[model samples]
Target: MMNDESLICEETANFTLGNTFYRSQSKITRDLGVLAAKIYKSEQGRLRVLDAMTGCGVRSIRYYLESDADFIWSNDSNPENKAVIEYNLGFILQKNKGKITYKNANNIFFECFNNKDYYDFVDVDAFGSPNPYLSTVLWATKINGLIYVTCTDGRTGTGHLPENCLQNYGSYGRSHPAAQEQVLRLIIGSSLQEAATMGLGIEPIFAYFSGSTYRVMLRLLPKINLSLDNYGFLGYCHHCGEYTTISYKQLGKVNCYHQQENKYYNYTISGAMWLGNLHNKEYLKTMKNLAISLKWSTVSDLLSIMIHESNFPPYFYTLGEIGRRGKLDIPKRSQLIEALENDGFQATNTHINSQAIKTNASLKQCIEISEKLINNSKVGKIND
Candidate 1:
């Protein structure tokens, strides 16, 4: 068993994390970095961001240190974490001469500013799930602004185990890779649907998965339609595991049932577009580039495995090779075999698409190999 103290140190040393954050190394940080770089280059409007659960203040610090955001507010439920965040923010303020605030508050319902129109970006990074904090996060974000959310409860959201999708997001069944991807979509969709019920409109522009966490960065657009029925759930076939997405347009609060058993199943429909694969090429590229640029070798390797092992088509390549016109150099089949063996992976190569490729390797093996590569590279070590 991993000692709690050791795990905490591992996380802090590796990611410069503070206690109270859910995960040690967050993919949300990398995604935010990419988003920040893009927004900084654009130089559109003065950006105000809120790190809702500012455990260790890593996310807030990244935004303040790397992004062009004018003002950042970091908050946490724990007073200790709040103090740590304040200490970190003090350094940032001294260095950048910027405005940053640290607060101890339960973000589930905390009102940070008297003006409801204060924040442009609100990031919700929670331990288990982001569901409980949805309403407050939506209220905090300005209309047409970006809202970034990270859900750490992969087991429940990704359909790895039996979870009531309807109860969670007022949506239907889940998909495999699709379930994992759509989990965030449904969360965001449910939030928007709830807001619309109160005569508000928000459209999701971008969403993706990073490591164990699934993130959605959305743009709250102009209020076009205000109706709760705009979003609904989906039901999955328990037997075949086929996706059956139902929307408010089609099914209105109908209980999801299994056809074979002829019994009401604990399932409900979710987002309008919940029936699809999770891997988005553009988003994957952006994430990969950001991970590499950050020198996060472990993240880069894990992302490579996700892309290679996932159902993504062969046309997709790593960011390093994307858009380069050339005959793809097929590495010697022995190279993969040797690498797998060296990394303690029980893997073998098979011919697919007339090219030698590795197959049938367990996810555990892939992770071990990735970790080995990262440890050897030592490119991702951060200051404590």
Candidate 2:
């Protein structure tokens, strides 16, 4: 039992009563709060929300208190967590007249199966990779409903060896920034594929990375008249740096390069590179707006970095302006190429009108380039 003194604080009072609840809220949760608040304030209709693996019901409670969600269902497999959820909802129920339900079940798989009702918004916050619960969440969500997912298995999902991630997620890839982004996308894609098998379609609307966690928000769209199984994976050799992009149907083979050549070899095939741009313009706009509203400086900084490197226009700009403008004012195309070379990024300007650049470097050269860009302060801003 939580001590009585622990219950008296304002912060503690806002959360569910339990030893298993999160000690401090995560950035992902806080960001979710901002998005949920926006959705609640914008939409006038009744909203039904669910928090699978509610633990101490921090997410569910936030929705109850801050949003117009008519009903909030909080569930956890642990009895103690359920009890704490009940304790936390007491004050919320009294103040907002909101309906809160607490249930005990294996939320990783079974809770959605038992619940007959479909929710407008479903939040899944599992302790690790959320792969186990994707099917259930898909089933229990209403068509066109929003689903928020948090994957906490960063060490294995996003940060692990590419081969290890492939072995676990049935998709493989390296742990570079692009690869990490793809891993999260692959996990979501796998879930969407499963849902598609059941005649469902999901449109991912937002995704972002926070410390050790990748959160994605998707909307379950109606089953459009189309087949969804036209995606595949890419395998890359870590030793020789050779890459092969192949479909799921072509993934069965046994080749032991180590046994044949007596050298250490590793490769990863990941599911997230879905052969398309993951974020559409609308989604990017929403993310930009959310970032601005929340004053997320790091996200802004990363956006700037990505824009400078990719030579893409600002998120808020129109395509016409992007095209009509001869060049972006922030980063000269040539400077970006040089920066990419200095940072060891395999970048080449494929712009038909621009010059192409490529590099082949030894391991030592790659290390030096990386260190020079990341460690040395003398490399002034490329955009400047």
Candidate 3:
């Protein structure tokens, strides 16, 4: 039992069992909130935060304690958790008093979006798709504010259902080896479209796959960019494994292939998705520095890797996918990286998948390199 929330909780892995809190996510959520709060404080000073869909008020308290916030609004719809939240807040106030408010709202967005109100940070950690809250969250966020959103519907994100993914995210889906990265693009793209409607723009502050969901923190801006002056699309060529990303203006000329021009065919499109850089280089560098300065144990390592690989191209190549396409055995990750680097192409391991490499090398170059190691006698050195 924690005094602050008077939260008495039984921990269980099975969520189907009634009222069992998922205690395992506590540390991850704590670190993430701390990181978000500190980043907001550095850029915008004191924060006014909303811990939407808060369960038992743990996250709101964590943000209040760890972040440099002036206020925190923790809201949950479930009436059963009201006592638990009150107990925690009552005890918390006894120790460190702050302007922390609690509310029981059946639909959280209506409360946040009701007026000309704004918050420096709006965190929507919803149970499922997060699609329902995207528009409202985008509207409630202040210019120069931050929005940290999560989507637990990995099935739709990873392209398990084409129609459902399209319906929710406005992008037709297909399974790519880089499905997780694709999901990041899906969520960001969806938010961008919603923001653009109000002449707002969002730039990625941080994005990553954590546990069973995808979480992204974005910096909201009041002005919109011309490329995103409208919606967008991703023209993917299955034959050559290449993609051409175009905005609404360029969509008319989009073709899978043009034989005379010698472009690859078999293109199936996915978009109204944000075809933007996944990681912002300078921003990522700053976060990495902050992580180290704060002595964050595990996330710092991941953040460091993300910063180092930040300069690589938007998409990635999987070793197994490349090998299968070439009818050859997959080379060790280090060996593949070595081969690409030897050919003057940059290569690095991706956090998305160990066997996946984020590289500036084209898909053809990657396939060619893999074939060299396999079809040639050079395969002997792979074991060494």
Candidates in order, TM-scores: namely: 0.58, 0.64, 0.84
Number of the top TM-score candidate: 3
Across 125-226, the per-residue lDDT of candidate 2 in tens digits comes to 766777766667787777777878778776675546656666556665455323445555666676666677788776765555555667767777788322
Tens-digit lDDT string for candidate 1 (105-153): 3433356534554577777766667767666666676766666767777
1 or 2: which has the higher TM-score?
2
lDDT, candidate 3, 1-384, per-residue tens? 333233343221111212524455545555665676777787777788877766766666666666766777777666676655665555445655433444433245565567666778888877778787777787667888888888888888676887899888878767666667778878888888778788988787767776677788888878875265334666566775665567777766666665567864555666666666776767766766777787775777877767767656556888877887777888788888999899998998877776789888877778889888766646566655
Give the per-residue Cα lDDT of candidate 3 at 183.
Answer: 81
Q: What total of clashing residue pairs does each candidate reach? A: 19, 7, 4
Q: Candidate 2 — which residues are off by over 4 angstroms?
A: 1-13, 16-18, 23-25, 40-44, 95-116, 158-168, 172-178, 224-230, 237-268, 290-384
Local error of candidate 1 at residue 242 (angstroms): 4.2
Q: Considering TM-score, where higher is better, how would the candidates rank from best to worst?
A: 3, 2, 1
